[model samples]
Target: MTELTGTSTGQPPTVDLGPYADALTHNPHPVYARLLEKSPIHRATQPDGTETWLILGHPEAKEALSNPSALSSDPANATPQWRARYLGDPNARELPQGKSMINADSPDHARLRKPVQRAFTPRRINALRGTVEEHADQLLQGLPSDAAFDVIDDFVAPLTLGMICTILAIPDLDRDRVRGWADRIGFPTSAEDVTAARHELIPYTDQLIADQRIHPGQGLLSELIEATDDGQMTPTELRATIFLLLNAGHETVISLLASTVFCLLSHPDQFAALRDSPTLADQAIDEALRFQPPAISAPPRFAREDCTIGSTTIPGDGSLVTVVLSSANRDPREFTHPHSFDITRPPGELLSFSHGVHFCLGWSLARLEAGIALPALLNRFPDLAPAAELSALKWRSGPIVRRLEHVPCKSGARSSAAPPHNN
Candidate 1:
């Protein structure tokens, strides 16, 4: 175990988070709070033994995310040792060609994101309201009204997966296989397993794009293919973009839905508040995002040059850097009663969707889905509550995203007009 040093004041010592990895995976709030009391910028050692910096303060995270000149998103900007240990050596591993917008900076990020932005416009996302509602209604209708069921498997996962698949125009027959590959790639048992999954997915993505090329459909993939023809994006870029969309598009929303439900069920007052006033759905979503963001940290950014987030100066020699989104969202300096889960809490500087150039592209769509689903679920089952103990609920272990494995929920007779039972 790494030595724990430093206090809430003065220059804090560099702490290794390796020991708290499990606890952080299960319940990160307490650990994050303890760290925040020490320093906004803390030096940390990665599992691979590489030194890194974690930015935990709201203002500091925003600054680090906003300044791409000092911190580069491209893996190429990483030091050779850090890259080799984490991502493997360039020569040894043949990485997929082209860069997804998430990994690109400046002009490239802008260019890649612009074409997709049109597809996610207010009008476009709003048009999916019917689809979102329809899916939520259909899924809820299928659930046993008075029995324990996995909210994730029976409702949330399918709702989100369907929306993303519909957007990508993936064939109904291939959706399950695609989702399986995506889950494997996103949450692998080991580096080797993730590598195998990526290898399998890359060829499938190439073929998917090729099919879109020959037989254009109404999907975004076809539009992206057209964009490729206009020289806005390349063949490899199209494949990478599709892969990113398929995985990130659904996975984050799943996390959002699960986390939101967990938060609400754990706090019956808030859940009842949302149940009583459906209009607070949006506010509830915002509060849930702030209280427990889907992604714990943004993807690691490399230091292009020496950068100082607070008093801590990150070295210029391609040091790895991560902006802790969950930490920043809960920063006392940013919000009143940062630890409290209040749906009525006004929206503020929440870093859930992140900031600056690398902001999530499908944020509108995500909000649209959650805004509809949350209210619908509560209305359909007014007496909904978690079947299992909230404290003992398990979360998936990973570095970037925080996800619940399952949300075993029990509900009463379906009745939209019924008042929630006080327990």
Candidate 2:
């Protein structure tokens, strides 16, 4: 509760995200560390006059998140602007609040997550390991031999976009559109860009939802649809759940995988060290998530009753809790040497996914994807180095995360990182 070095009470911060978007597109560490230590819970004012509490401290973040009474992830009474634009209109009977798994409570959450869980079982993921590797290989093969390429475009983006299509049974989805939507959503250009992507994606998803019902197959969406027809969930419930699956499960992996690779490439010795011990790649993924988590902030939370997070007392019912996820990932109260990227760092301390029932359900999927991709990439291009001016590289300055705009690197480029790989 001590005042960190340079924080001064000024205007409350809004989720305008122009700066955050830029930082993410560039590098956001120094800013995030500053915010976390000094202002664990800074006051922010949004353009809509909506005030937000930015929980930047790691311990404070975990406390705020686990406090069920204080943070409500549901959008039942969300701002009209958010409801209409993101969740769809309720009064208009278009996209109602109770239509999805995300907006559901405990019993509902269990019910919705249960069936989806069955489809995304560990066995299912393990089975896809080879396919995932092949997918990575294909993307790598497409890159010009011994040429500089944008890692985001040439590899990470396609693997994720294609993977999502595989999960949804959308065999013929416009790969370009899928990649575009996921990228824009992950590191949006502006607020308008975020809004417009949503508007476009909704109809596209709606159409897909319709097709899944009629011509269902062996994908997550199709499986959910099968569950719905079996009276496991209502049709309306099915569409929203599918939407959540697509939206939540898509770009997060891309951002995480892309960000982790960018981290490795930035620190060539570290990259080479890991290449020498490839299994460390998984731990590196965890470390990268802790060191530079993609989901920069928590989903919106409104107090259901009253609560106290640490010494600060938050008033009842109307309070909006903003979980600074990156802060928690680096909270000294939680991790040993919060800033250092220790791949073998104990998992119990990291909250990059989260810490409760509301924790990321797709965490396994994210880990699996990163585990397969990271080592495989380095194993393939051990001598890789940035072809672009990494010093000139920037992060998108948004509340969401720290992510690179693009990672342009020279494949097979000689480096002092490590000995050339078998590839």
Output the lDDT of residue 51, model 2.
58
Task: Name the 10 consecutive residues with the lowest summed lDDT in model 1.
Answer: 414-423
TM-score to native of every candidate shown: 0.93, 0.84
lDDT of each: 0.82, 0.68
- On residues 1-423, what C-alpha lDDT tens digit does candidate 2 reach at each position? 223223354434333333443343344455556666655776654434455677778778888878764566666644455455444453332343136655565677678778788866789888878878889988877777567888887888778767777888765547677656655765566657776775677677778878777886767887787788888888777767766666667567767887787667666666767877877877788888887777877776766666777766665544567787877777777778876666667884777787676787788877888888877777677777777655666555343444666778887554444321100
Clashes of each: 0, 27
lDDT score at residue 198, model 2, on the 0-100 scale: 59
lDDT of 1 by residue, 1-423 (tens): 357666565545668777776767787787777888877888776544567788999999999999998999877788887656556574332145458788887788888888888899899999999999999999999999768998888899899999998998888888888889878877777877776787789888898888877888987888898898999987887787888898889888888988888878767778778777888889988998998788989988989898777778787888889899999999999999888889999779889999998888889999999988888888877788777767767888554777888989887532233222210
User: Which candidate gets the maximum TM-score versus the true structure?
Assistant: 1
Clashing pairs in 1: none
